[model samples]
Target: MNPNGPLLHFVIAAGLLDSFNPCAIAVLLIFIALMFTLSKNRSAILSMGFVYIMFIFLTYLAIGLGLLKIITIFSIPHLIVKIGAWIVIIVGLWGLKDTLFPGKRNILAIPIGSRQLIASWATKATIPAAAVTGILVGLTEFPCSGAVYIATLTLLSSSTTFLKGLIYLIVYNFMFVLPLIVLLLIAANRMILEKMINLDEMNSDRIRVISALIMIGIGIVILKWFV
Candidate 1:
């Protein structure tokens, strides 16, 4: 596994930025609720939750590997990354604009429907206890963050092996999941969760804006070295 040294910082920032995302933060709240409902054994719930997240990590690993293979085959890894940078930058700007300008909500995404698909995928995995966890974990791979991750991995494919791609993906997911795991253990109580969810919702738009700016910055970072 390539050390991809200190990409950890970028991935952690990405994860925290992801937490600020409305869907991500809300799903974490939902997971906290599920954690309470799923088991009275805190250890079991936490164990299952980690396993649940591992399952997500593995699934995305497959995706990252596939993307790397495709890019390596095409001999356009850097180009793929550059394209991804543009996409990340644009998505970030759009989210920022949406929050700052209060645009007429032209976006009509179906979050619940997507959640149902995630639920179905989880159930099909045959681990019923992990179903909700799958849904929650899956939601974090939204358009913006997912695009950035995908693009970066694809671009690296030319230089990184398939194993490295998988490793980087694993790192990204670990960092991404850490916050919720820590928070759930410390503040799984309904009052705390509700307060977090409410506060998250109130500031979600601003979070989106900030996340967008970050994405834009990351995009520029990638493009800078290339140019």
Candidate 2:
């Protein structure tokens, strides 16, 4: 195996898990439905979707950089990573609980109170509306699905330089928004919205399980790295 294989695995896996966040996808689905209803032209909807994805990408990249800086400022970056790894483990366990006993409420998604707000904003569905909704979703969804991102940033803070870190962030964010881009394409083609929503609802639990597994795997790798 290549020397950087583990790092590559962690980054890509994290990005993929984050990308499949069901809560974010739910918001995106709603956004798409609203856009379809609000705008007559498919091109306008695509434009709005692109703008929304861009905001999410930029916001997440900025957040990652900010966290990376904080991690670097710490005197004991390795120790901090270890602690963060443990936190990631806990996060994974929580995800597992949600997956296994899905009815139980968890801290891994947007609050019920905020769902109404997100829906309200997304209902506007114009370019500016999409932009604002994108910012809101990106910021709000962080606490719900940010473990993989946090773990990755912590690891990178101690292990890589700034330019490399930026590149990794770019890759991660690209992967993060990829699913949304695809969904936008489907919507632009005027596919059945109800089917997509139904599909997401059916798989949301599985998404949680997969995310938990990947997070646990990353946590284990981090511990082994320290060993």
Candidate 3:
């Protein structure tokens, strides 16, 4: 077996799971809703959605590449990875608490000010506005869904060459946006879009729990092997 196969599998799986980020999904839904209100043209809505997803993909890819470059340059110590692993675990636990307690405190959310800005951009319902919103959400939603990403980056730093890591980062970001792409496709159908929105709202807490578990598992795996 290729020695790196397990790591590659983990990266793909983490990327898929990370796509369920509540903040990202919420923002996309908000954009979709705003688009519906502003325009009756299906093509225009899809165009905006595509632009939004692409910008998010690009933004996240840039962040991963930048982080990888910094790690390579600084020769980030293994101890830091270990610490990061623990932090990931803690963040996962915090997510669970937030889910169960119904928001006693939510440190993982995008800031309210940033969310308002995103909403304002989304309300514009144009390709350029969507592109900007995507960039903003990509930057701001990290705290809400970054534990898995941090774990993936740590694993990539320790386990792969920089060139290979870059390839994985591209793949990862694509997977991160895959869900949005699906939503964008079905968004042309108002009924289906409404159903999806309702479903997401009903099970959001459950989804959060699942996401938290995955993060904790990834953290443990990193501590065991990669760190």
Candidate 4:
């Protein structure tokens, strides 16, 4: 199970960085409200988020399978360590860009922006923009698919069963929002959510920029030491 594994903090840190990213934050807040509107207890809220996160893990696992096929060709020594370092830096840069340009979104590619999907339960259907948003954020939030990401790929590749890797990935994802969830509670229910929604655009941008830079710097240190 790799209990007490080194990857624990690394994944948590990456998730945290992503959770706070401008795009990620926007989606997370929306999802929080979405889930709250649907069900409000901590358990219910977490369960809804789990459904969304599991969807992400399902897709990531599929990617892991595809990567397994690709890994064999260059499997002659994977540079898991180096790649992890690179991912850290790239993610940092991505955050830095958004922070500096608060109002603008840097994504240019087709998959860079939001996608629409229909979600249904018991014959009722609604636009599950938030779930889609959550899934997208989970996938792209990695600074760069580095050694950590690759090593995760490598582990999934080597495993006889995929559940092990998938479980780790899921846990890693949940930990990312622990802080924000806590912050939400401390703010006294969704009362302050309105304030978060109404935050001054420029001020919010500057805050994100500074936080993203700090996250990037931490990632560099991770590459240098931990990974």
Candidate 5:
């Protein structure tokens, strides 16, 4: 079997699912709203949004590279891949619980203190502040949405060279941020932005359910084939 084929499919599917993560989308909406209040110029808002998203891409890519390096150095990619697959399954179940129960303690959420800090940075509406906020979001949002990422990295580490894995990581992270890029593009129009926000809110639970299922499915596949 050609491993790259299934891996590529998984990368694209998992990346798209991760892109709609409620945590990242919620933070993005908040940031866009704050940006609207801070600046009336559409160009300024877009510029800041671009910077914010660029930082998010960079941060996530860096983390993937770093983890891949560590896994390579340790020469335990197969073990780690198996462990990551189980973790992905667990995270999917946890997500489903959070969706169904709707109030149980969620250890996967961004910390309140970190959220407050991110809010403060969002309020600044400066490029540097946007960069910092993006970095913070990238770090803090992982627990909420990083199971797929870990699964991808583990699989990559086990089956591909670092260079090939790096290429996949770049593509995966790009797909991961594609939704945010779309949101940023439409953010200049208040009515459209509000509609998108409304849709996101209305379908948030459905999205979670779908994402959970995908994660569980991917984990099972990894355990069955890649492990």
Candidate 6:
């Protein structure tokens, strides 16, 4: 249960790749736009955004902890790690497919079933409303953005104690939320949302390609280390 270089690398890499997912970015953008319309008060906007991000951080952490427990409880750690490596490889290849074929959606993306719900929840701008939206969005977006998280949890389940896993989960989620915080700050400064949206659109393919490569690298590392 000692932390090692590969384990830490996988955790951090998974978080960073997962954070760049288009679905999460889109929801944050919508929330920011709604916040702008709700009030010109920069302080209030930043405060509500913080609340939203806080909820997101909490929700994701809770899920990671819960998953760690479940994964540890149900199977032998080594077996689970091997299974997880295969899953990561499959998901990595799926990402590669999306990058190569551009129009076809990646299976790892947010599920169609949850997209409408996520969009609906993201429209709320009040602190309570945004907090609830954050929780819901975090849960709902899992299917679309959970590959890295699952892989990291699988890695952790095999190699770390509960407390260490908790600490690593905190680190991973912090990295996950870092980009959203940066985007929120940018939007708070009166930068246009359209520009951000356009930028995402422009770089999305390249992002996918980069994400695919990283996932593949992590998958290979896990496969080699575990299998």
Q: Model 1: how far is 216 from its true place, Å?
A: 1.0
Return the TM-score for each candidate structure: 0.77, 0.89, 0.91, 0.58, 0.91, 0.86
Give per-residue CA lDDT, model 6, range 71-129, as digits (tens): 98865887888777777677778877877875556754666667667557656656787
Where in model 2 is the C-alpha error above 4 Å?
A: 1-9, 102-104, 225-227
Tens digit per residue, CA lDDT, model 4, 38-150: 65666655545555555554555455456555654454333644464465556556756754564445431113333222222201212354355445554554332222344
Model 6 residue 81 CA deviation in Å: 1.2
Residues forming the 10-long window of minimal summed lDDT in candidate 2: 1-10
User: Least accurate stretch of 10 residues (summed lDDT) in model 5?
Assistant: 102-111
Candidate 6 pairs with clashing backbones: 109-144, 110-144
> Which segments of model 4 are wrong by more than 4 Å?
31-73, 76-80, 101-164, 177-190, 200-203
Better of 1 and 2 by lDDT: 2
Return model 1's CA RMSD, one decimal.
Answer: 3.9
Question: Can you write out model 1's per-residue Cα lDDT over 1-227, one digit (the tens) per residue?
Answer: 42445454555555455544455555556655565654445565556556666665565556666666777777566677678778777877777777677765612122556666654544432345474555455644545356566546654664467776666667666766676677666555657767877877787766667667777777887677542
Tell me how many residue pairs clash in candidate 6: 2
Candidate 3 lowest-lDDT run of ten:
1-10
Predicted candidate 5 versus true structure: per-residue lDDT over 127-180, tens digit per residue: 999999999999989888889889888899888899988888888999999989
What shift in Å separates residue 186 of candidate 2 from its native position after superposition? 2.1
**Per-candidate RMSD vs. true structure?**
3.9, 2.6, 2.1, 5.9, 2.2, 2.5
Score residue 94 of candidate 5 by CA lDDT: 91
**What's the lDDT for all of these models?**
0.60, 0.79, 0.81, 0.49, 0.84, 0.78
Better of 4 and 6 by lDDT: 6
Residue 191, model 2, lDDT: 70
